[model samples]
Target: MTLSELIAQFRTLAFDKVEPYLFDDDSVIGWLNEAVKEACIRGQLLHECDDVDICQIAIKAGQVKYPTHPQLYEITHASLELTSINGGKRTPVCLVSFEEMDKADRDWRDDQDKHRLDPYFLIQHDTYVRLSRPTDEIGVLHLEVYRLPHKMSNDDDVPEIHLAHHEHLIDWALHKAFGVPDSEVFDLNKSEMAEQRFTNYFGFRPDSDLRRITRHDVPHTVKPFWV
Candidate 1:
């Protein structure tokens, strides 16, 4: 596409016409590419949630990595765009930002202790590599998303609302991106479909008892809460 056309497409995507798609496995790395590159330029992208921990890992080992939010947004957006044009379905997904990561502090700290650092650093990381592949191809995976204005509980906060709204747009864009099948999408309860598909894609597994204990005792656990 021409640069102007690309920019127009991006504008449509940025202005509530699209949503993000994410992966279940980091090793797949099918979604990384332009998103991470864009994030690197925007300064919102990070290699790891905690650079200090990544540094430590690098000191001990030869390589280290993490995820960035912008990259996730970019890949999910790109994936949806690719799929939409190529006749595939799109799913709603988001990158865990520092704040989103912070919300699940207990889980993250525990992961740090066990894995030596949290794996699946950010959505950005996934798209970074995927976008860079020489084949100029994108991967396909299952996704389910819902319509907007998610019902909130009495105590839900502002960030949650913003994230939810943005996520909804990303989902909408996925349909545009993938030519989502009318039969397979948005006919039944959207939220139910999202939850069902998400659970199916992510799967459910019990956390280890030892990991739970470590998660409870991780130092400076609240630091990320403010992020």
Candidate 2:
């Protein structure tokens, strides 16, 4: 829904349709935008691999580390874009841990081969990427990743997530609205209940126990088995 429509609906549901609202338009909009972010991360709803700004990284010769997109939650796949050097052949790279690389080759971090072309493994911390082999020349890294939602500001702006998930986002806004600290309208009980309902639908958000949990809610969906 558009922000205006959603805000109106929120007022109706929140019983704040009357003027001198317990929540201001700015507050409601902020809560709604927060809801969008919570839903996106909790559900992995904003799956992005197509946008160049999100998926493509510019490589510097001999530079092994690169920053990831700020909104990224997890990277599912990555590869060095090799079209220019290997005649359009892409080289798929493995995601590895620092410890795993150290165990395999203790001096791996030395990066002696500045001219190395093929990278075998990649080490990705949440916000950075380190290549097994540094590039001989400038290159590109293509990544497949799950990202967070953008915050909405204007009344006409609708969330980027699928419309099916929009209605449920209200639960998060409700949770936040009632969660205001020490305000006359703040009710801890209402906040907790709203949060519980939000959790039931979106499977928990940034905090409150189940935050780190991953979901495979549908049938035939297997748990992630990353190597």
Candidate 3:
């Protein structure tokens, strides 16, 4: 649904009279933005895999600042290559803690030839990835990063989550919108119900394997250990 539609739906749920809107546009937009951010963080709905450049010139000794996408929230997978060849096959780099990366750097400094094959990364300042060593050559780095779902800015904008999950967004917005009391009573029950509904939908069966698995896929008997 569009941002306007979501706002309208939220108003319907939170207000008795729609002819005279109780909430301003900015107020509704704020609630919607919060809802989208919460949903994106809680669920794995927005993700993208793209090639990024770790510029050779950007390298200082054995580290290069890994560029970040605007909407990036987390990096799921990353691969590095020394050549510009797009499909030559790339090896995945292991993400390690700062201590591990420091060790790798020390090892490289001691004997570059001995640890030349090891490539590791540490997130620096929560913005850039600091490589243990600079690239042997210059090329693009491929990354699979989870992104923050886009905020609804325009009325035409649709959410990044699947359409089936869109209702949860409205539920979250309504919960926040009605959290403050408009009358003597706080209306805590309604707000809590909306919050619960959004949580239920957001975390619904997150770990279940969606792939079709049948009995044929299971082993009927155990085989010998050696075999």
Candidate 4:
């Protein structure tokens, strides 16, 4: 099954679990499906051939720790709890890309901020999307990263989601290996910190102008990324 289809089915089960919280079942389902689809696409294989289950393998193999999408929910929950956090001020959802880092970048890497090197822990299955507000003056954009488990052995289940397209397993290796945003870091000692951090983390560099600058204005009912 495609990611979207898989998630539609899972929504029923998830809704029952979170019925007391009044969480919007549809939105959660959409977000999860998107994560899975992205994961499969990055793997460059059909969902069935190389789905997110590889993420479980990564954990079992001691590659990384957690799924970025679900971890995002944790981040969102924390953001929501703070009265200081506002819609525009607080970072919106993060967009994850399911691509592995290049080895050339890895061999040449040399930076003091090894914490940013966390991308080595993540596989391509995990990424995130972040929304920016007018006041923040940043454009809405997706933040694709490698995700890893925080505390799990090599035998954990992979995070999965079914969208309309197919069922995809999360790339926990990429999720754990994600690069933190310059905004996320409290220090600003150098202008190259973010760039350096991404290199160390993902062993790749994104465009500097590519700062969080895209918006997910469309409804989840429509697949915007595909369009």
Superposing all C-alpha atoms, what RMSD in Å does each candidate have to the true structure? 21.7, 5.6, 8.2, 23.3
Better of 2 and 4 by TM-score: 2
For each candidate, the alpha-carbon lDDT, in order, equals 0.29, 0.79, 0.62, 0.29
For model 2, state the Cα shift of residue 13 in Å: 1.6
TM-score of 4: 0.19
All candidates in order of TM-score, best leading: 2, 3, 4, 1
- Whichever of 1 and 3 has more TM-score, that candidate is 3
* TM-score of each predicted structure versus truth: 0.17, 0.84, 0.70, 0.19
lDDT string, candidate 3, 45-96, tens digits: 7777643432211333344566565566566666665543335466676655
Task: Work out candidate 1's RMSD over C-alphas.
Answer: 21.7
Candidate 2 at 208: error in angstroms?
13
lDDT at 5, model 3 = 84
The digit string of per-residue lDDT tens for model 1 on 41-128 reads: 2332233322232211111121223233321222222122223233544332233444445666635533433223122233233222
In model 1, the worst 10-residue window by lDDT is 53-62
The 10-residue segment with the lowest total lDDT in model 2: 209-218
Q: Which residue runs of candidate 1 sit more than 4 Å off their true CA positions?
A: 1-73, 77-94, 106-111, 114-227
Which one wins on TM-score?
Answer: 2
